[model samples]
Target: MRKGIIGDILHGEAAYIHDLRYQMKMKTGEGVWRPYHLAKRNGNLYPTHGLGPVAQYMNLARTDDQFNTIISYSTPAIGRNKYAKKISQRKTYGINRF
Candidate 1:
C-alpha cells in the first residue's frame, strides 16, 4: 500500500484494490442484527486500513487539494446473490464447482 502511494506521487492517479475480511462471534442465540453487537462491530470512526493514510500523505486534507471525492456507492449484495444461485444450481446438476 505504501508502494502504491509512492507510485501515485511519482507517477499519477495509480489504481489499486484491497480486500479485507473480518469475523464476528455472536453470543449464544444472538440475532445477527442485534443492535449492541452491530454497534460494536461497526463503530470504527477512523479508517485504520488502506487509502486513508495515503490520501493524508498526499495532503488531501488541505483545502487546496486537487482531487475531488467520488464514490460508486454500490453494494455487492446483488452480485453475491447471483453467484450463490449459480453455484447452487451447478452443484444440484452435478456440474464442476469452482
Candidate 2:
C-alpha cells in the first residue's frame, strides 16, 4: 500500500465498490466495470470533492480584501507514469492487475 501503484490504491478502492454492491444486493467480490480509473488527460480527478464544499460556503470571507484571482500548480508526473508502466508490464506478463 505504501508504493505509488495504481493497483495498490485500487485494492483500497474496494471499500467504495463494496458499499455500492451492498446497496444493490450484489456479492462483495463482484466484478467491476472496466475503465473505473480512466482519468482524463490533465483533468480534475475528483472535482466535486474539492468544489462541493466551497460552493456551499459562498459567504466566506478571504484574508485579503483584494482577492480577485486564484492559481494552482502541479509537480512533474513521474509517479503517475511509473504506475502506468507497471500496469503495462503486468499486461505483458498476462497478470490480473485488478
Which model scores highest in TM-score?
A: 2
Name the regions of candidate 2 deviating beyond 4 angstroms. Answer: 1-40, 59-76, 86-88, 92-98
lDDT by residue for model 2 over 40-71, one digit each (tens)?
23433444455444433332233322325433
Best by lDDT: 1
Q: Score every model by TM-score.
A: 0.30, 0.31
Q: Please give the CA lDDT of all the candidate structures.
A: 0.38, 0.32
- Model 1: pairs clashing at backbone N, Cα or C within 3 Å: none
Q: Residue 41's C-alpha lDDT in candidate 1?
A: 38
Q: Candidate 1: list runs displaced more than 4 Å.
A: 1-31, 34-49, 73-98
The 10-residue segment of model 1 with minimum total lDDT is 19-28
